[model samples]
Structure formats: C-alpha cells, structure tokens
Target: MTASAEPTPDDVVSAAKALHALTAIPDHSPRWSNTAEPTQWTATHTIEHISDALLFYSGQVARRADAKLPVLRDGRDAPVSEHLDNVLSSAHVLAALLRDLAEERAFHPSGSADAPGWAGMAVTEILVHGTDAARALGVGLILPENVCARTVSRVFPWIDLTLARPPELLLAITGRFSIDGVHSDPDWWWQSAPLVEWDGLPRRRDVKPGWT
Candidate 1:
C-alpha cells in the first residue's frame, strides 16, 4: 500500500480526468484491448475493474456516512469510453461523499477505513490501474505527484519513501513486478485501515489475523 496526506476527492477526480484525456487521443484509443504488461488484464478489463472497485468503495463509504446502499457491478463489454465515464463518475461520487465525512469508518475485508483511508484507496486504484491501462495503450499516466506522495504516506506508512517515490511504489503496490527502480513484495498487502492504527509492519497479506 502507498501511504501521506489523506487523499482528497479532488486528487482522484483530477487523475481520472487526466487519464481520460490521455486515452482519448486517437493513437491510444485503439489499443484498449492490448495486453497491459506485468498484468494479464487488457486495458479495457483493467479500467472496468477499477470502475467496479470505485463504485463498490463509494457504496461502502456512503453507507457509513448515511444510509444503507447496495453496490453495483456493471458489465465489462461496454465501450472503452463508457468505461472511462464510469471511472470518472465513481471518482466524483466517492470524492463528494468523502469531502465532509472522511473520518467515518466503513466496512472492508482488509480493515474498516475512514474517509482518508477510502480516498487513499480510491486514488491508488485510479493511478495504479491508470498506469496499467496507459501502458497497454502506449501512453503515460501523468497525475499530481504531490497528491500521489501524500497518498503513499497515508496508506503505506510502513514504506521508507527514500527507497522509492510514489509513482514507482504505486505500480509495485500489486507486487506484480519491478519498474524503474521499485519492486513488489508478493507478501505485501495494502493497509486499508487508518494509518494511525498501523503497527509499523509491512502488513503482509500472507499473515493470518490475530498473529503477532
């Protein structure tokens, strides 16, 4: 998990828009189905997966902030443009919900999270999967570095930022492979819970709960 400043809805909103512009270019649009290296999912599949995740998270946080809501899972065969639309739409809704009540905890399999934790997860999905989609499309995903840095600090407090920057860490977060100078630990897992709750460990997913 990347850890920093609680990711604002604005940070994710901006990154999704940037990805939209990058993929909208004629040269990149045609490669939507191409393989995104280091991951088997196609560009379209990766984006669709991100959309599903954001929508799922939004529902969780919204429920925590107010009423009970069921999450929606859209079909994957939709056009690439519609997929991007869903990504942006989900980001907007999640961001808005988090704007005022970022501190509220929501249910998560990994751990319950407040607004910052949710927002950090949202941005990480947008930027990291954005990297996957962009790589498959033959373009680079450029978002706010400061925002990414803040995100890394907040969600991945266990990492020493000096070893690598947020960009590399984002890609390696999945522990698929190394990029630039960063590598993933298959044992590594996201710290979906609040940073203040971290125990200064790597949050290894391989470890069972209640294990000291």
Candidate 2:
C-alpha cells in the first residue's frame, strides 16, 4: 500500500474484502500452523487478536453513549476457518460502525482515548497487523495503495512519504518494525482524539504520550 491519496470508508471496506480471501487458504499448510515470523503470536493468534480488537472498538461505538467502554475479548479457541470467519465478520462490523459514527458525529471512546477518526485506526490495523498475519502464513498481502497511503497520512503525519512505502511506514510508526534510518520511535502515537473540532463530544483531558 503506497498510494498517496487519503483513504475513505470505502477503502476500509475494500481492505476487509481483501482479508476475506484468507479464509480460502488451506489451514493445514505448514505456514498456517507455524508461528508468525518476526513476532511471537502464531498466525491464528494474530488473526484472533485482530478480530478481538475490532470487536472492542465496535463495542466502544455501539455501547451506551455515556458508558465507559469495557475491555472485551473473543476467546472461542476455534479452528482456523472459524477464526477467519470471526476476523471477516469483525472487520465488516467495525467498518460499518466507524462509517456510521463518523457520519452521525457520535461519541466513541476507548477507555480515556477518543477515536473521532475511527476509520484510520481500523484501516491501520487491517494493513499493518494484517500483514503480520499474512506474512506468517507465507502469503503475500499488499494492501490497496490508496488505503495504505491514507492511513499513513491520517495517523502518521510526521513521517515523510519519501522515506518509505506506506505499509512499511505504518508498521514502523506503530512500533511493529524498523526500517533504515526510520526505526520505530519510543514516542510514536496516532491522532485518535478529534482531528477536527466536534463540540459536545467527550474528549480526553490532555494528550497522552503513548500510541493507541
């Protein structure tokens, strides 16, 4: 994913659509069963992590307007096909919820962190961590160029586009990997609070140093 244009909700959906194809890949393959390279989590565990994170974000948006979002998990311990199904389903649900919340100007907070630009957060996970899972399976997983570019712009404004490709940059920004003269920094973070002024929404008292 190296496109330069900003991403839209449509891009998020298309990325998820791309992820759905993983279900068809044979789970019995050694790659699928092996531990994810460059990371401790297995391919199945990484997919499960993605699914659960999306589920937690969805809860933040769909739960009561004034309620503090609870940390949630999907611990089914199911087979590969079931995990794939869970990932696809969770991604679709999160995409739709993000679109709706952004459109309606709804309040969505994860703990004390508010995510007005929810689409960027969702797309970032799909591309960066999705790559983690795909690579572990010994499969190629290139995100749509435009989607990747948009995520980089929205979430990692400090990075120069010329420094590296968008997907690689995104991973580095999230502290997932390092690149030449572009290693992950200790203070990396995304603009999760309202990027624009949205009056009457609950916001954090102050900006935190850590990444969301």
Candidate 3:
C-alpha cells in the first residue's frame, strides 16, 4: 500500500503525542559521546536531532502546501543546555502542528519537482529516531504493529543488505527495523558504509532511500 493509504492527520497527531510522552521521561545516562564526527550526536543528541527535524518538516507543512524546509545543521558545538532546549521547543512545535493538521491534506516527502510534503518522512522519523531516543533512555519503544509493518515494507526494498552487513543493520540504516533485529545486530556496520558504496549490495533500484 502507498503512503496515501497510510495514517491520517489525526493518526499522526496521536503518534506525535505518544512520542512526546515517551520523550518526557528522564534520561540520566551521560550525554551521547561525539565519537562519530560530523554527526557526532549522542543518544541525547539524537533525541535533539529528531526534535529539530520534526520542527523543520512541520514548519514546511505550515508555511505553504509546498515549502522547501531548511536542513538541520550540526549543533554539536552548541552548549548542551541550549541544544536540549532547542530540541524540546522543536518537538513541541512538531506536536502542536500535528494536532493542528488533524485529518487535513496528506503530506508527501518525495515532493513534486517543486514542493514536498512531510507525511512519509514524519512517520520514519518518529519510528526510527523515536526508538533511538528511547534506547538511550534505557526504555523499550512499542510501536503500533501496523505502523511497524508498513514502515518495514516501505523501507525494506530501498536498503542493500548484502553489503557485508546484517539485513537488520541495513534495515535500521534505512529506517525499516521495526520488527525483529533492530538491536540484535551487535555491530551497526551499515551505518559506517557510504550509501553509494552499498548500491551493489542487493535490492532493486526502484527502492528509494528513506532518508537523504
């Protein structure tokens, strides 16, 4: 099934509310380590990243039926508190937007040559990044079974699992690890490989990259 048959605006709002509740819990773990340069985002950093991303996408939804939103910059150098605040504020904006758009027009991330919507992108973000943030907090995220299945089906073909990496890891990289094997892969090698390099691994070309 296509994204048009997926969740509605009210559904997105409900999902966002559930995610907000998940992020509200206290995370006592040491902030994420910036070991991975460039995207040196730790667990908390990932949470902030997702929050920021949601805001960016949601803003586009609000500005116009087709507004090109700005990409997120590396905020690693920013003060931790400031970053955290930005994340929280962004998340709030996202949640509010979702609520406001209940059952409105459907968003399509893969925009027409001109404007793109955030529907599919939002679901992928909430499921994957939401799981990442929960993992950092030592909590387990129980996503809706249908959502998981749909996301997996949509993201599965886009990934190259045969590139010296576990199918699960590849799925995670492409945001499809909703079923089993999400955390089963001890080493996340797919994350280390260049996206282009994995083109020869497996899967068909019709499969689109879930995230850019």
Index of the highest-lDDT prediction: 1
**By lDDT: ranked, best first:** 1, 2, 3
Candidate 3 structure, TM-score to reference: 0.50
C-alpha RMSD for every candidate: 4.9, 5.3, 9.0
Candidate 1 residues lying further than 4 Å off, grouped into runs, are 1-4, 25-30, 65-70, 176-183, 206-212
Q: Estimate each model's TM-score.
A: 0.82, 0.75, 0.50
Instruction: Tell me how many clashing residue pairs each candidate has.
Output: 12, 0, 1
Q: Each candidate: what lDDT?
A: 0.71, 0.63, 0.45
For residues 37-57, what per-residue lDDT tens digits would candidate 2 score against the true structure?
555777777777767667766
Q: Which ten residues in a row have the lowest lDDT in candidate 2?
A: 203-212
Whichever of 1 and 3 has more TM-score, that candidate is 1
Q: Regarding TM-score, does 1 or 2 come out ahead? A: 1
Off by over 4 Å in 2: 1-6, 64-68, 103-116, 175-178, 196-212
As for lDDT, the candidate ahead, 1 or 2, is: 1
lDDT-best of 1 and 3? 1
